[model samples]
Target chain A: MTESVLASWREGPVKQAIVDFVALATTPGPGFVAVADRIATFDNDGTLWVEQPLPPQFDFVFRRWAQEIKQDPSLAEQQPYKAIIARDPAFFAGVATQDPEVVGALLAAFARTWKGTTPEEFDAQVREWLQTVKQPKLGVPYIELVYKPMLELLDLLRAHEFRVFVCSGGGRDFMRVFAEETWGIFKENVIGTAAEYRYADGRIVRAEHALGSLNVGPGKPEHIFAQTGRLPALAGGNADVDIEMLEAARFSVLVSHDDEEREFAYTSGGEASLARAKELGWTVVSMKDDWITVF
Target chain B: MTESVLASWREGPVKQAIVDFVALATTPGPGFVAVADRIATFDNDGTLWVEQPLPPQFDFVFRRWAQEIKQDPSLAEQQPYKAIIARDPAFFAGVATQDPEVVGALLAAFARTWKGTTPEEFDAQVREWLQTVKQPKLGVPYIELVYKPMLELLDLLRAHEFRVFVCSGGGRDFMRVFAEETWGIFKENVIGTAAEYRYADGRIVRAEHALGSLNVGPGKPEHIFAQTGRLPALAGGNADVDIEMLEAARFSVLVSHDDEEREFAYTSGGEASLARAKELGWTVVSMKDDWITVF
Candidate 1:
C-alpha cells in the first residue's frame, strides 16, 4: 500500500471508499447520479474526545459535584451525595445510571450549570477547564489526553465530504457545549442522552432530573435515529455499546484500546466488548500497530 | 467595489456573508482569525432550499393527499383531511404547525407514507418527484430553481472556515436530510423548528406536536439560542419573519424578493419585517440590482 493507503487504513472507512465511490459516483455515462453521500458517526467519549477512567463529561461532572460538596460539607453525609463529596471512586463504581431518579437529578444539575450559556462563553469555559484540569495520573490537561489518531481521522473524513456526528452515550447537551471549540464539531449534530425541559419566564430551561438511563450500547443507535434520521454510511467506536451504530452503517471499525505505552490499555470493567466487535467483521484498530500518534 | 463583493451583493445576505466570511477566513494572519470568528446563520426556506409557492415538502404532502383522495373520495368530506384531499392551497396556507392536533394528524399521514422506507427509497422518490415538480409560475425543478449566487456564497464560506449554520422556521430534521447534498453544508450545523417524537415497537415515531414555536421572525433568535447558544456575528433571511434573526447578528442582511422578471417577484403575506431589518442596520439586498443570475 502507498503511504496514503497506509494512512487511510489508520483513519478508517472514508479513505478506503474514496476511489471506488468516486468511480461509481462519477460514472461517465448519462443518467449518472453522484450522491457523493458520505455520513460518518463517531462515538464521543473514546472515539472523538478523551475517555480514560471514564468519559470526560463524567469526569467534569464528578469534579463539579465534588466542588459543590466542598462548599456545603453537609452533602458528604447523604447517600449518593456523600460518595460524591468524599470523592470515593469505590462508591461511584456501583452507581447505576439506569436508575431514573439518580440520572434525572444529575442531568438536571448538569443542565443548570451549562444551559443558556452562549457558544462563545461555553467555548471559553471548555478551553479554560481543559487547560487547567489534569488527568490525575497523567499530569496533563484533559484535552491533551484525547486520542490523537481519532483527531486525524476526523480531519480525514471531513476532507472527503463525510459529515461527522457524535452518537455518544454521554449527555447530549453536554457534548454541544464543548464539541465545536475542541474538535470543530457542531452541537446540533451531537446526539447523546435526552433530558427533560421546562419553560420559565418565556425561556426554555432544562429541568434537573435524578432518573434517566445512560444512552449506551443499544441506545446509541436509538438516539441517533431519533435525532438524525440519517444512518451513517461509516462509523467508529471503542466499545460494544457502539456496535449497533456501526452495524447500521455500510462501514464499521473499532478502536482497540490496547496500547498501554502510548495510551491506556483498558476495557470497561470485565466484559471485553472489543473482542465481539472483531467477530462481527468490524476492523479492529490496534493502537500500537495502527497509530503514529495517540493522545 | 471588488468583483467578489459585487458578486456577493446579488446573492442576498445569506450568500454575501458566506463570500465575505470565507474570504476573511482563508486570508492570512489576523484577517483569517478575525473573519473565521464571524458566525453566519441562514434561514432554511427560500433562503436555503426552494420554499416558494409553498415548501418542497408541502408539494409532496399535497401530491400524496391528491393520490389518497383519488383512491378514496369519502375522505374529501372531512375538515382538514378534506382540505388535504382537495389539495386545497388555502388549507396548506393555514398549516397550523403549532397546534398539536393539526400537526399530529398531518405528521401521522406523513409518517404513514414515509416510514419503514430505506434511504434509497426516500431519495429515489424525491428525485423522481423533482423531475416533474415545478414552481407553478416558474415551471422549473425546485432544485434547478435554487439561487445560484447563494450557492457561490456557500462555497465561498466553506473556503474560509467561518462556522455556518442554518437557523430557519422550517422543520429541523428535514433541512438536515437534503442540506449536505444541496449546499455541501453539514447536517449538524442546521437548526430549525422541531417536532416531538415517540418510541414504539422497535421503531421511532414522529409525534404530531410541535416541539417548540415556529422559529420565525422573533422566534428565530430563540431557536438559535436553544440550538447553538450563539448570537450570530453574521446572519441572513428573506422575509419580514427573518427580521429578528438578521437584526440579532453583528453583521446582518435581508434578501429582498423584489426582482420579478429574473426570479419570482412576490412577498409573503405578513407585516413588512424587512423594513425593521433595514432600520436595525441590516444590509438590504435588491434581487434585481445585486444578482446576475437567479437559479
Candidate 2:
C-alpha cells in the first residue's frame, strides 16, 4: 500500500476515517467533491494548539490586565478585574465549569485592553507577545505547543487541494500574526471574532465594541457562511463551543483529551462534545491512542 | 519578445505601469514581493464591470423594491421608496453627486429586502436575478458586461501567484453568487459590505442591521485589513468611492470611462478620483485610448 499522509497517526479508527474520506473525495466517483468545494476548517485554540491551564490569548490579556490594574489601582475593584488580580480559585473554577457569566466577564475584560488600536498596531502587539511570552507548562512559545499529528492532518488535507482555514474563538488579528508562520495558512483564511472599525482621519481604527457575534458555538457556522459562503466539508474541534461548527460539516472530528502524561487530560468542558461525537458516530480521536506524539 | 498578458491593451502609461509593477513584484529585485504577500484587490462595480446608468446591484434592488411597493403600496410613500418608485431622475442625480443622504436612504431600502433570509436563500435570489436580468444598454447579462481586459489582468495576476480579491461596496452575499463563474475568482475572495447574521433553528439568518461600516471609500482598506490582515499590493478602481482603496495599495490603477462609442462615458462621479490619480502620478487608463476592446 502507498504511504498515508497522516504518518504520525497510528493504525486506528481516527487515521482510517481521514484516509477513507480523502480517498473518497479525491477519486473520480459519486462522492468526489470539486477542488473549489474542498474547504476544511479547524477550531484553533484547543484543536490546533494548546489551550490548557489557560488559553494563550487569556494569558496575554491577563498580563495586560494586571499592568492596567497596577497603573490605576482604582480599577482593581472591578468584578472580573478583581477576580483576575486576586487569582481567585473560585472565579477560575467557574471558567472550568464553562459558566456563561464567567466567560462573558472574561471576554469583556479582554475586549477592553485592545479596543481602540488600529489592526496593524494590534498585530504588532500580538507579535511582540508571541515572541516574548512562553506557555507556562510547555516552556515554549504558544505556537510551538501545536499538536504534531494535527499539523500533519492539516498538511494532508492541503495536499488533497483543500483550502484550510483556522476558525478560532481567539482574536482574529492575534491568530493572523502567527497563523502563516506556524500553520502555513494564509492570514485571510483565519476567521475569528473582531472589533468594529470606523474610518477616521484617513485611516481605519478599531471601535470599542465587537462587530456583532463571537466566533464560538453557533457563531462558528454563521461566520463560515458570512465569510466563505459555503460550509466546510471537513471540520474539527475539541470543545462544546465548537459543536455547532462540527455539525455544519459533512465530516466532523473531535479531539478527546484523555492523555494526561503527554497533554492535559480534561473531560469537563468538552463533555457534551465527546458525548455528541459518540451519539452521532463522528470520529473521536483519543490523544493517547491516535497520536504517537503530542507536540 | 514573449507575448504580454495584456495583449489587447494599446501601449501606454497605464499598460506599462501594470507590466512594470508585475515584473518588479515577481523578479528577484528590491521590491520583489514574496508570493504570500502578493495580494491584489479590485473594486467590483465600474472597475471590473459596467456601473453606468445604475450599478447592476441597484437594478436588482430596484426590481425588488418595485415588487415590495406593489405588495405594500404604503411603502411607495416612504422617502427613498417614493424616490425610486417615481423614477425621479433628480434623486439618482444626487447619487452621482455623491450625496450622502441620498445614498444612505437608498441603502436602507436595499437592506430591508434581503434581511431575515438565510445566506443560502439570499444567494439563490441573486442567482435568479442574474439569470433573468440584463443591463438596459449593454443588452447582456450583468456578468457578461465585465471588462475583457480586466478579466485578462486577473488571470495574469493569478498566474503570477498573486491572490486577487474583489472588494466592493455592494452586498457581500450578492457578489459571492457570481464572482466564481464570472471573474474566475472564488466566493471566499470576494469581500464587501455584510449584514449581521444570527443562528436560529440550525441555520444562520441575516440580521436586520449591517454589521459595521460599508465597504466604500476609506472602509475598503479597513475591511481589507479586517478580513485579510494585509494591504493590497496592487489595487484598481474607477470612481471616488474607491479612492482610498487605491491610496492604500503599492500600485494603483484607475479606469476612466471615456469610450462613449462602446460604453457609457461619465467623468462626474469619478472626477475626484481622476484628480487624485493625476496628482499622485497613478495610472489612469483612458478607455478610448488604452484598450482596443471595451468588453
- Tens digits of lDDT, candidate 1, B15-77: 455456446545675445454345678886667555677777668657877787678877667
Each prediction's DockQ?
0.17, 0.63
RMSD of 1: 5.8
Give the CA lDDT, 0 to 100, for residue A7 in model 2: 75
The most accurate candidate by lDDT is: 2
lDDT of each model, Cα atoms only? 0.63, 0.85
For candidate 1, what is the DockQ-based docking class? incorrect
Q: Tens digits of per-residue lDDT for model 2 on A1-295?
A: 2575777789987899988998898899977988888989999888998898878988888888889898988879886898987879798777545577887887677667766677778778888888899987778988788999999999999988999998988878788888898999999999998776766666677777766677888888888887788888999999998988998888899999888888788986798998889888889999889998889
- Cα interface RMSD of each candidate: 5.4, 1.7
Q: Residues A116-225, candidate 1, lDDT per residue (tens digit)? A: 54445545666566668887677787776667667666776676566777778776666776677667766656777745433334344444441133566556655565
Q: Poorest 10 consecutive residues of model 1 chain A by lDDT?
A: A204-213
